[model samples]
Target: MKKINRREVLKKGVTLGIATTGLTGLMRGRAQPKKLRIGFIALTDCAPAVMAQELGLFKKYGLEVEVAKEASWATTRDHLLSGEITAAHCLFGMPFSVYTGIGGPAGRVLPIAMVFNNNGQAITLSSQDFGGKVGFKDLEGAGKAILAKKKEGKPLTFAMTFPGGTHDLWLRYWLGACGVSPASDVRVIVIPPPQMVANMSVGNMDGFCVGEPWNGVAVKQGIGFTTVASQDIWKHHPEKALVFNNEFFRANPEESQALTKAILEACKWLDNVANRRTAARVIGQRQYVNADPDVIDARLQGVYELGGGLGRRNYTDDYMLFHRGGQTNFPRKSHAIWFLAQYRRWGMLKEKPDYEKIAEAILAQDFYASVAKELKIPLPKDDMQPLGGFIDGVTFDPKDPEGSIKKYKVREL
Candidate 1:
């Protein structure tokens, strides 16, 4: 609740020996970091930033950090542009959109590191539209029912978090793939993740997509059911990352690296499978998601509860492990490319972007690679290349994106 400058925190902490001056001095000399100001939304995925600071990970690296809770993604992006905050726990394709100028205007945002992957994100459907299936039992079947209702002159209404965030894309992609045109066949609306359940209760939206504790809240309220997960759509799909303005990273390279190192360390702790329950409790605290431990704990450990008889069980690839023995946080170039292609597929990008050039500019693979090497983490065979794959039977190749774009059975942007 109290707002203070990053330097002030450092100044106060250093004098009291709460945090060493050595780390601060190193960063100041390296990046001339005036202050390590970072912002985050109230999502569980933003845990690393909170955990890092709370658990002394940042102090260990000599970071005088200012953690601010942002109200919305648009506000967060604006703060990043004006330098109000140095960085943020941001949406996956956010930096790419900022660079391409699609979401707001290109060339305004840059990503420093992918902090985590495969966290809590889901597609929820209202009880009216639940129809008794759970956990992607029949995406096609759901789409067909919605479409049939539309043809009878009743188009199903759906909701997503933001215009360009992953929830929007996933909801659109899933609906489009099921022979339903998201833009045409169904009315896709924008609702904040926190408001998803309340909006569903109004009988306005037949389904919605958002990240957790929101999804779990819907299931608990008995207003909606978990129909699909972002990870389920594409196993191990990239979720959230640490994004910043390019100017920040360019100006404070060492500080950026230091922050990345600190976050990676926090990630390692969170991914230790054994630490899942503890991480959940920490995140569920008022500083982060502010939800009950039960809601936060289950999904963080990949244990799922489907309200509509999909049954309860553990998902092997639900949440991402960013720092587990160093496998979790590697910012692979393929990850960035996949997001770009998805942006193009959704009409966020009009042209067939220069894949390699775009990937190099937005994704900090070189930076990540150096840090990984320094820590003795093995690099993937190809760092700046694309990796192709099939999602729900649709093949996507980053190399031949133009063809891949055309091959999509759904609507093309």
Candidate 2:
């Protein structure tokens, strides 16, 4: 991949030239409908799909898109596989899970269209459990407290959205960093994003890792305090993405490209600081995130109230971003390699899979590059690179994923 200067492209005022009309115009000769049914969970990251629909970007791109709100990540994955929905606002690691048959059936490959956003998800702990002052930096103390509770025959439980999703990875990494074995030292459960607050409110889990609005909602309800934002774990890390079934992508390549272009436009629109307020208001609707607009707006604007007397802070550098200098939307092969490495570390895979082959198979980097080029979006020079500068002072080299995993002492394998 050649590195194209995004600023130069923007300076030229280039638009999604052929993508806006090329595919849809050609499909007009056929009897197929231009309509598409897309699936999304009620989280702030779903903004691109919702905003694309609300702002008429889909229509502008000749796609009649129907945004379906899903109950959970599992349901979204199943719908995509069953062809009920064409694509999804999806977890970054989901396509890999589907490909490896971790949570779903084996021997199926799903395609990731593009990463929708980054740096927004968070880990939240119950304020009641920690007397209102525990966070990632205090994880060692938190771990000892959790162990003490476990010694009393009551094991502490944590929740993530899915078994092999972004939330699961963040929770596992955070726990492991603190010397708490996610598989042994605690009981981990799968909970949907919308259900996280309700479950925690009733004391179902001691802590949870989930996407935005919910984490902010937990704080609003006085149930949990924000331990750390995912960005704090790894700055600008890949979060949610747009994923499609391989069959769907093959059957409707033009339509897929059109959808991607629409969402990409939406992403560019979202990164603007001025649009944060409206974006929060729109995604907060009942048919979408179904949460208080103020709760969503706070984090969307990079304003935080950790709750339970943890204090408030403004984090311009560590907020959720849909497009930060044209970097957030590309689906890097390195990101997939990291996910596979973690799966191997935690015993999700029996052997080290061919990371490059799997990443190339699932992430549609070629298509993304084509669409990006057409839209004049700058492309990174390398598809694989090192992800560094973690809160734990650990570095992940995509070239040596196995070595990266070996460096961790708290993994199952």
Candidate 3:
């Protein structure tokens, strides 16, 4: 792991020659707001927003920021929509789900300001079922065992954070890849991230897919083991993103850009291996993730215990990354289209959606590009890219989402 100097990083960000060129001019003659309210859930991926508040990055950008730790993703969505908070550390699929009115009535479409982190979530299985036989490769046997249980009139249940969130998608994809039907073989339920371990301890479900710390906590408590880290399902997959209300973004472009820049710098600082320990400690405080720092730190450093005496292994490349070579932060339309494709594949949407149009509306690419250029962050040349391969050997083309949907053998559609 390479060491990082926080002071030097901050100096570079603050001293960027073009930092104040075009965007800052929008703030001229406008009264600077006293404070910006942001929301976050208790998860490891919320590091960027929490770190920005703790490390004074938000203040450094001449913004007084208030960070609110919310109880659930639903609360985060409601607050973001009702103007209680201007932006939030949001699930990647949340903005689109709300826009399309899948789980409920349609609200104002939200836009992703930037992607906060990627590739640290996991799918955990209860120890009681597999008897130490939990791994992605064993999903077929697991499905058989689940079928046997169902034959006795007890269906296996699995949980994810939200209906259309990344956790839900990962769990479904993994189950489908394993030749198990997510819709038929098991009962999929919704459980909050922080409550996942507790619920599993009470034997509420057979397994769950959620963000880190909880998965580590389950392993520590002797209740479950990780069947697969999400990265194994899809390496460098997009996870939580910094999302804002579209109306708020349009109404306050300058403030939005400033906030985005602050988070981008905070993300860069977080990627430094040297800062991870302290980052874990700060994020572990009561108002943030509120978990044991050691548990959070373990996964943050790419160290996995896997519980039940599975021993320890280090995974350097596939851990949670806030800013990895500046590739993680860009809000790519391709990623949005992929989510839309999943929604269509899983029958979350009634009919095929205008993939490009909805992606353009919900992902503020122009604003993100402007901020990236201002911060000297290198941008990807094109908006559309292949799904980049999956554990099931299925690749999706963003250009033909319907074709991607057709490739899924176990889709609801």
Candidate 4:
């Protein structure tokens, strides 16, 4: 995709004939919404959807965006499939799961339009059980202890927001790295992100993997301590994305590109660290994340005061990036391949599916590229990268996805 020069438009100063820029054409073709609804869950990463509506970016792009606060990931998936919501702030893996029939029926194709944010999620472990004994640094020991605890009659349970979602993969990988099988050594359950802390408080789950500020909230409530930040597992990892129903994506290219542009603008605004305090306060209202703005902002700014006597650490370098100069929004095919390989590794797939073909279908590169071209944002030179940056000293080569899967000794397949 050719990266247009915004400076040329600026250099022209809206002169008569020179004013018809690509962005102007994008702005001219306004999308008419009969009932365009967008859904979001209550997590810090939902800021993109919130900001897009609040900051008038959707309006700026001539789109009508109705924001729906979904009860859970499953609800979001249902709305997307039924066409109740046109788009959503959704788990990057949910669409893949649904498409591959991992946790739900197939046929609904939810394509990822733009990634919302990355690296603000974490795994919270019960303080009474895993506070100091098992932390991020001692995962090898944590694996052994978790297995030992499970062997004491009652099987220890771990919770994630959705089946075959990013949180599930992270939790399973952490457990596997610690030399424990998520399926055999312990019980893994699906719970919504907002309910993670409450369930833990009632001793329903020994640990959970979820997005902030729940992890921060759990620490403050003295219920659990953050064992590890998701970024610690994989730095700047893609978490959530703007997902739209397949029909909406393929049928209405103009509307889709307009929506993507609006979201891209919102993402740019969100990355401006200076606006986050206010952003947190806005999204923290009763209709949104519904947590204290202070708690949300703390993690939003990469400050962590881990409870259970665990010290605080700052992760500004890798914490919750919404737009890394458009890199964050550019969905990578390699990331999708990794997630697919993970599904295969865990036996979520009966047999290996066409990983690249599915990834290509899921990532709406056309819409994203059009918006990037309109916005003059440069695309990444390469689609695949040597995805490393893991807590385990391992790297996933996108070229050889099967090899990457086999490298894991604790996998089901």
CA-only RMSD, every prediction: 5.2, 6.2, 4.0, 6.3
lDDT of 4: 0.84
TM-score of each: 0.87, 0.92, 0.92, 0.93
How much is the lDDT of residue 17 in candidate 2?
A: 26
Candidate 2, which ten residues in sequence have the lowest lDDT sum? Answer: 1-10
Which sections of candidate 4 miss by over 4 Å?
1-23, 33-35
Q: In candidate 1, what residue range of length 10 has the lowest lDDT sum?
A: 13-22
lDDT agreement with native, every candidate: 0.71, 0.84, 0.82, 0.84
**Candidate 4 lDDT trough over 10 residues, lowest sum:** 12-21
If candidate 4 were superposed on the true structure by all CA atoms, what would the RMSD be? 6.3
Quote the lDDT for 200 in model 2.
92
Off by over 4 Å in 2: 1-33
| TM-score of model number 2 | 0.92
Clashing pairs in 2: none
Tens digits of per-residue lDDT, candidate 4, 44-75, equal 88988887777666776677878899999999
Taking the tens digit of each residue's C-alpha lDDT, what string does model 1 give over 154-269? Answer: 89899876676777777877787677877678898877666677888989798988888788887788888788777767665667788877787888778887787667766766
Residue 239, model 3: lDDT of 96
- Candidate 3 whole-model C-alpha lDDT, 0 to 1: 0.82
